[model samples]
Target chain A: MKPEELKYAKSHEWIKLGDEAVVGVSDYAQHEMGDVVFVELPKVGQKAEKEKQCAVVESVKSAFDILSPVSGTITAVNEAVAADPALLNQSPLDEGWLFKIKPENPADAETLLTWEQYQVFIKQA
Target chain B: MAEHELRRTVLNETERKAGGKMVDFHGWELPMEFTGIVKEHEAVRKSAGIFDVSHMGQVFVTGPDAFNLLQHLNANDLKKATPGKGVYSHLINEKGGLVDDIIAFCLSMDRYLVVVNAATADKDFAWIKKHSEHMSVTVENKSDEYSILAVQGPNVPLMMETFAPEALPLPRFGIVEKDIHGRHCFISRTGYTGEDGFEITCPNDIAVQLWNEMLELGKPYNIIPCGLGARDTLRLEAGYLLYGQDVDDDHSTYEANYGWVVCLDKGDFIGRNILAEQKANGVKRKLTGIVLSERGIPRQGCRIFHEGKEVGTFNSATYSPTLKKGIGMGYVTPPLKPGTLVEVEIRGRRVKGEVVRTPFHKGGAFSKVLYTGKDK
Candidate 1:
């Protein structure tokens, strides 16, 4: 189950909004991608446009693009996940968070789906 | 495809119960992975793993003219495959293109068992039958009647001691009939993963029992049920070609870098004239291995460049779990030597790489036990 405190994107990324918006893939996303072998994390101070490709997550079979959910300036990147990609599969929500984005517009979180809505959205997908 | 519409092996339910993530593989509902591809791949390299390979086809030929029929059809010299031995050969068409690559096991002086790729099973059988019209041989497709399990790794020899002791002394590519759980099965010391292992072919009735029993017996060795995902990665690491992906009807044995299997002096056979001509003149393009110097996965159809010009395209490529880098095999004209610098175009970006010798993961059983009979 997705955390009720977070909002989700249609592309499967989940964001927790605060002073700095934190982004990571959802539980369903990690499960669908199978094992994560490599993670190309976005850089700090980089521009992250809403719904734009910001990072790359590669499994043993193929690679996937991780899009930013909210337009912002990247503040922090996860060094731990960059070193060990399996962290994305093991603990995708907390330790596996990709990056921190200082949102350009905090109200953009309202445009993203809520936890309950994301549950329904994935079911329909 | 609907779940019910897909074909299944006898151990399909057993695999699902073991938490296999099922997917459609050539119309068969098989597990793409169990625990995970990297984990399963590591298990086989370090310990042991089991694979359900029942999707492969088995064709039996028997009669007075069985030997002659296969001898004429296979590009390799089948005469060397005496009874109880197997020969890996390419079935080439009259145009010198591959029909399929197969392992023909000489069961007796007048009977042979041919194992073929799953997707080319029907075509291979038809090709064989079409060639044997005048020959007195009975060709039968026994794909549905049998199930094949590949038990592979560094720990296979030790595991076989408790599981099937009779399989221990068999040499590589050797086949022996052994009794397991009151049923007879063919245990061949052969595998695609470059491991010292056995491919056990048994009737479908005993498949479930054998799978469960092998898993239970192999617990001490950390044996896990591997899936097709790991199988592909493992084979790629070993530099073994996938039939339809790495090689197909468009390629001949010489161009595919499998000329070693083509015995030109073995007398008359299908595609012999063209293959001999190619052998005499050498191929224009040859299959070669590539390893990336940097991060980034190179996938199939990725263009390969040399000296800032497009030279070839990848036929099969993957992230090597063993090497922790990008590796692939592709056809490059005027084949590049090992260590030659090149670049691969991935996602419109050129990544530097180098040509390398194949069987990329050299620490497997083939390097250690199969040749020296001692662990490194």
Candidate 2:
């Protein structure tokens, strides 16, 4: 689901802004990765840098890095998705959310792409 | 430096129209996936899947001395393969390093067909010609004249019954010439996948037509078109050795876990002395399968460690869809038993795993069948 309220990263990760921003890979990214078999999640309270690899997702044929969309400290992680990696392919934007980050700079969301802009950006890619 | 242009097969446009994700593979433009790797992989295991294997090379050898030439060139005993039969063999260098692994088909007493790897086609042809200087055999490369389509899985028999009647009654490793929808094709009951399947070779003009017919006949059986992505994982899970990765010029046949295919008792051939000596003593390292005990994916070039000491590296590795765990093949020091514990360095962390018997996911038709030299 392409929610207008959420921001997108060029690397295909999505961020939902709030008290604690929810971060995940977009549906398009999951589609491109094929069936995800394993997800290595970052531990809670770990600091992450923007545009840097903070997690890993492994498919049957490939392994891809899930870069953090914004610099933050990970406040929470979705253990459910880690247990069943297929959830990422089935609902990448919803129940398949990866983790929640407490951003160091709350205004970082404005630096990301809007949902409509992401749709166009993906087309060009 | 000039960029070399990539070649496309006869079914290239058809594959593109069917949603195949194209990629450059060994100088050929081909599909890496159709629907998706896992979906296509599952389709082959559960039902049937077709692959455009036209990028593979085909060479023709014909003369009164064809058998004599092949017997001296191939590592496997060529005398066992009668007409209408095919056997997998490796063409080796004088030092026992692999030149290229191939399938030799004996069409008649004086004619033989050799299918070689796409990347090594030209080199293998030149090597064969150099070896046949004194012999009267004519070696011709006919890779462009034909296209190959592989229909693989458990549902292949039903599809053959509808479209390829001649191939339906053929025994395993048997090759038969057949007319399908007015086009002549060579159908062989052999495939790289560990499932019961068929490989049909036809002229380029009718290649797309044959593919369409096979798809139509296979429709009821839920046939899906697969690409190279699934082909790699399927063969890896089946314990089949890939040429460049698993077996190459550095490793001999015995070290590659294909010692069974080598006929040491047979008369003199290329690398026979090296192979005989290796058999009498032993190889320093052997190719073995590994399955991870923890949740981690082992990748190519990953280091294998035993008690914190590096022993070898993974040559080919993938996440097995059937086993739901990381599975791989690598060259490790010998004397490592099937249950020997080891660690694979995935990414940076050491993941626990164990050396195991190959053909990781069993219960396929090819694994169960007992070949008795007869058609079922």
Candidate 3:
């Protein structure tokens, strides 16, 4: 089950809103992509548009893009995940957080699906 | 569009119960990975792993003219495949393009068992039958009637000694009919993972029984049930080509870097003339192995550049679990040398790479045995 506090995107990214939004892939996303082997994180100060491809996560089978949930400027990246990609599969919501973005409009996070709605959305998908 | 039903092997339910992630593989519902691709890959490398390869086709050619028919249809010299021995060869069309790569096991002087790729089974059967029209051979497709299980890794020989003792003395590529777990089956000392292992072919009814028995018996050796994901990565690391991916109807044996399987001096075959011509005047594009120097993964259709110019595209590529690097094979023109520097374009960014000798990981069981000149 997804954390009730986080918001979700249709492309499967999850965001925790605050002064700076923390972003990572959903558990469902990580489960669908088996055994993450490598991750390409976005650089600090880079501009990210909402729902745009901002990072790449490569599994043993294929590569997948991580879309930004809300438009902002990249603030930081999780260096731990870069060092060990399997952390994404192990703790996707916590230590596997990919990046932090200072949201252009903090209200944009509210526009995204709530945890319960995200669950229903994925079930329909 | 109409929903197309996928075919399932006899071990489908068993694989699902083992935690396999099912996926559609060429119209067949097979496991993409069981536990995980990397873990399964390592299991086969370090200890032992079992694979459900029942999707591979089996065609039997039996008659007085079995030898002649196979000899005329394939590019390899089948004369060397005496009784109980198998020969790997390419079935080429009249235009010298690959119909499929196959392993013909000489069951006897009058009978042969040809194992082919699952995707090309029907086409290969039709081609073989069409070519055998004038020959005194009975061609039969027994793919649906049988199941194949491959037990591979460094510990296979030791593991086999526990249950199938009769398979211990068999030479590499040797096959024989024996009773395994109270069921009669054909066990061949051959595998695609570059490991010293056996591929057991048994009746469909006995497959589930055999699978469960092997897994139970193999627990002492840390044997895990691997899926196609692991199988593909293992084969890539071993430098074995996938028929439809690395070799297709558009590519010839010589162009695919499989000229070693062709025996031009072995007399007339379907594509001997063209293969001979290409062998005499070298192929224009040769399949070469490329290893990335950076952290990114290389994938199929990735453009390969040499000296700032595009030269080839990756036909088959994967992140090699054993090597922990991106490696791939592709047809490059003007054949790059082993140390030649190249760049692979991944997602519009160029990554440094170099052409290298294949069998990307040389620590496989088969390599150690072959290189040390061991009699076993």
Which candidate wins on DockQ?
Answer: 3
Tens digit of per-residue lDDT, candidate 1, span B65-170? 9999999999999988999999899999999989999999998989899999999999999999898898899999999899999999888778777667667777
Tens digits of per-residue lDDT for model 3 on B1-376? 9869999999999999999999999999999998889899999999999999999999999999999999999999999899999999999898899999999999999999999999999999999999889789999999999999999987777777767777777777888888766776899888888777889999899999989988988899999999999999999898899999999888899998887899999999998999999999998899999999998899999999999999999999989888889999999987898999999999999999999988888645455343222355
In terms of lDDT, which candidate is stronger, 2 or 3?
Answer: 3
True-structure lDDT of candidate 3: 0.91
The alpha-carbon lDDT assigned to residue B48 of candidate 1 equals: 91
Worst 10-residue lDDT window for candidate 1 chain B reads B367-376
Each model's fnat? 0.62, 0.88, 0.75
DockQ list for all candidates: 0.73, 0.80, 0.83
Clashes by residue pair, model 2: none
Preferred candidate (lDDT higher): 1 or 2: 1
Clashes of each: 0, 0, 0
Error of 1 at B126 (Å): 0.4
Docking class of 3: high
Deviation from native of the Cα of residue B184 in model 3, angstroms = 3.4
What residue runs in model 1 are displaced by over 4 Å at the alpha carbon? A123-125, B1-4, B363-365, B368-376
